[model samples]
Target: MTDDSGADLAWETLYGETAYMCPGFDIQREQVRLPDGTETDFDYLSESASVVVLPFTADGEVVVIEEWRQAVKRVNRGLPAGGVEGEDVDLEATAVRELEEETGYTTDSVEHLTTVEPANGISDAVFHYFVARDCEPAGEQSLDFNESIRVETTTLDALREGIRDGDVRDGRTAMGVLYYDAFA
Candidate 1:
């Protein structure tokens, strides 16, 4: 069957404001008009790019971090992830930098797993996943002024158990684990 989805649809942004402007995602509010002549105001968070990495050691343990997130108000275990600064910075480089900064682990080899949108409902952010191998302790974590992370290393089985028991609650971490299990 031929798709005529666009024939009856119309969308227009009436007004918008950048709620949170930063180097990463920028949150904004926009007023839109639908096809049926209904108008609504919507909030959107947009980002240029982001990265997540599954850092693995020679013994097969994955390096993770226990960090307190303000949004969730609890410490959660997650893989290394962050946003890129600009087009000059490659995705793998961003993954490596985030891994080192968050977990103090450095990897010489990294393979791309996938790119995904963790939250599409209210945000336009793309998460690029990578599997990093031959990882070793680098140094002290270079976190932001507001970040407090404790690095941890665990086997894949333990991670799986954490997921099964509803302990690993971070979406990016879960996605990285699933991708590593399937591909890495």
Candidate 2:
């Protein structure tokens, strides 16, 4: 069947079930019929949208963070980011909240940069990127219990260097920085 965009390769979902449930996401398995009439089970991770904030301080320095990432078993240097909680009013609000929560930085000029599905093949994770300018230290970091974050300041050039030298391994951070630099 042709999709809204006139694509002939759209697969029709026959049925869906939760293969596993977790705190932030769920493993969803669905029986789908391909365009050519073949049926198979497709699995993917489903989660709420998230936000990434590339905040710049009043001094024009970028607000960065160093956090211990359990999945990779190392400290990751990246921008302030988090999943959109129930209390978040919107994407920009989530971005602002996450920046302040992870780095104690607050900004009045928060703008949406872009949105991307970082891992489309395996997960349905939508990340909204925002650029927060004139960020100031409003209070001490109020990180989540599972978060171990250390706040710092840096320049965009230094961040670009980190991205080039393979020091910045977080895809969301890299995408935000590169997207802002290239477009905004």
Candidate 3:
């Protein structure tokens, strides 16, 4: 048997740039060399590192948020998530800030659960998953402009059921719940 695959392709990027600018992210363009030594242009999104926080109470309830997603034109239930603003902070800091800002849940005990890239084919964004145990209501939610969020708490079983029944529609939230259920 013989294996013929694109794996033998010697691909290289000639140059790249941020093509379009947005508030938080931008589109990137690059020229690439194919296996046949031919060149083509590649376009992708360049985003900063992001975080998803699975905040859990001492009694094992999970804190979640529901907010309007303009792209989908519906509200979504998801973990408190956001992108790291700058190089001055780390992933854990991003997790803590997002959790508090979106849900008003704060935790002194936070740990990295996992990192996922939802669309590596078109974006360079990494979603850092975090498990925040021993959380409590720290203060009122401080949302950004144009953000309206609702914070809710539910048991792990109920959360799983919501996902199974398609009530929870956010992919990162579903993954975060699964990770919390299995490991944290």
Candidate 4:
């Protein structure tokens, strides 16, 4: 007996771009040959990157940020998160910067938690998670031009409840907390 089953089709990305701002979206053009030997063109949206931080105090309280999301038009409770900036900025650095900028807390130790990809359908963004331990109140928050955030501290149980009740709807935050509960 002989088996001749393999992927012989090809998918070629013709063009792609970031199409919209605000809630940024990307568009892509592609050409592909189907398994049935039919050729076709397709379009897709590219993904972006995000970061999440699980900030903890010496007493074990978790630090979270409450911010108004312009796109969602609602206040969301979650960990400090932001997009990656320059090539020199690593994911851990992004987490630290965002945590400080959003919550006004600084930590000398940051440990990698886990990464999550919320939407693979349209975006290729990764949510980098970090555990910021031994956090200290540094100063007032320094938000970006579009950000309005408030910092809050909660017990792990309260955090879990918020997540279970959908009060903490941010996917990355939920994942980070869950990861902490499981491993950290």
Candidate 5:
């Protein structure tokens, strides 16, 4: 099918089933008709949108967190990030809260940088990116029982080296830093 823009509408969902779901995310199984009129099965994940903050100090140091990531079975060095919980506030507020919660830093200025589809093909996870300037020590990190995060800083040079050396393995973290560089 073609719309007003003459863009060929490609896939048509025949059916979908919620295979599994938890509090934060869900998995689905689906069958769809391809543009070529062939049918196939597909799977995808759904989750609440998330936010990542590239926080920097007044002197140009990027604020980061070293934390144990159970998914990776090791500690990860990455920017502060969290899910947009509830519907009470905006993505900017979510960034601010996550920064403080995971890093204990507050910023006087925060601005939207970009939006990222972390996993475009298989996950409905949109990651909003922001840059916070002139951040300073606010208070101790307020972490959940399962969280263990430590706030740290590094110059962009060192950060690049870390990423090159595989010390920074979080894709979002590396991507956020590169976006910060372009948008800085």
Candidate 6:
């Protein structure tokens, strides 16, 4: 047996430090020695692992959220997602918690679909996508102070149409829906 999985091409990180810090993420800069015998510095966003849940109601509708995204200067339509918090036990728990907290929807079953590095070149953002089934309204949405969210329910086909029509522009949601559609 042989292990030739590009391990030899890996760069050696000589030093790494936080260039900037914020509430959700931080900018990390690192000095590394490349496999080509060259040294350089690189910077990237360091974010916590997160989960994106595509929740489905028992009646076959999908749970979605419309939230104000300050960076994009618009209310973006997306699925329930959030960073893994300190108290979250694991990725599946975080997905369930985020689905309920962001959209007031509770699910009896959750299946992990896939994990992806959404922006590997610029950041180490690991997104765990899950399919949550039999979701029903639990209570009022419990959102963060900085969040302004509105919940909606629609058929899975309609959500897929939204993805095709460019109405669902959030990358995480789009990716989750498309991935589930193609493989799940």
Per-prediction count of colliding residue pairs? Answer: 0, 0, 0, 3, 0, 0
- Which sections of candidate 3 miss by over 4 Å? 1-10
Better of 1 and 3 by lDDT: 3
lDDT by residue (89-110, candidate 3, tens digit) is 6778778888998988899988
The C-alpha stretches of model 5 lying farther than 4 A from their native spots are 1-9
How well is each residue in 23-78 modelled by candidate 5, as lDDT tens digits?
Answer: 77999889999878899998999888889998889999999999898887999999
User: Each candidate: what lDDT?
Assistant: 0.85, 0.91, 0.88, 0.79, 0.87, 0.91
- For model 2 the TM-score comes to 0.95
Using all chains and alpha carbons, the TM-scores for the candidates as numbered come to 0.87, 0.95, 0.90, 0.83, 0.89, 0.95
Candidate 4 TM-score versus the reference: 0.83
A best-first ranking of the candidates according to their TM-score comes to: 6, 2, 3, 5, 1, 4
The C-alpha local distance difference test score for the whole of candidate 6 amounts to: 0.91
Residues 76-115, model 4: lDDT tens digits? 9888887776563677778788788888999988988877
Task: Point out the worst 10-residue segment of candidate 1 by lDDT.
Answer: 1-10
Q: lDDT tens string, model 1, 60-161?
A: 888988989888899999888877776635777788888899888998898889999888887888889999998999888999887888998998888988
* Candidate 6 ranges with C-alpha deviation above 4 Å: 1-3
Candidate with the larger lDDT of 1 and 6: 6
Shift in Å, residue 162, candidate 5:
1.0
Worst 10 residues of 2 by lDDT: 1-10
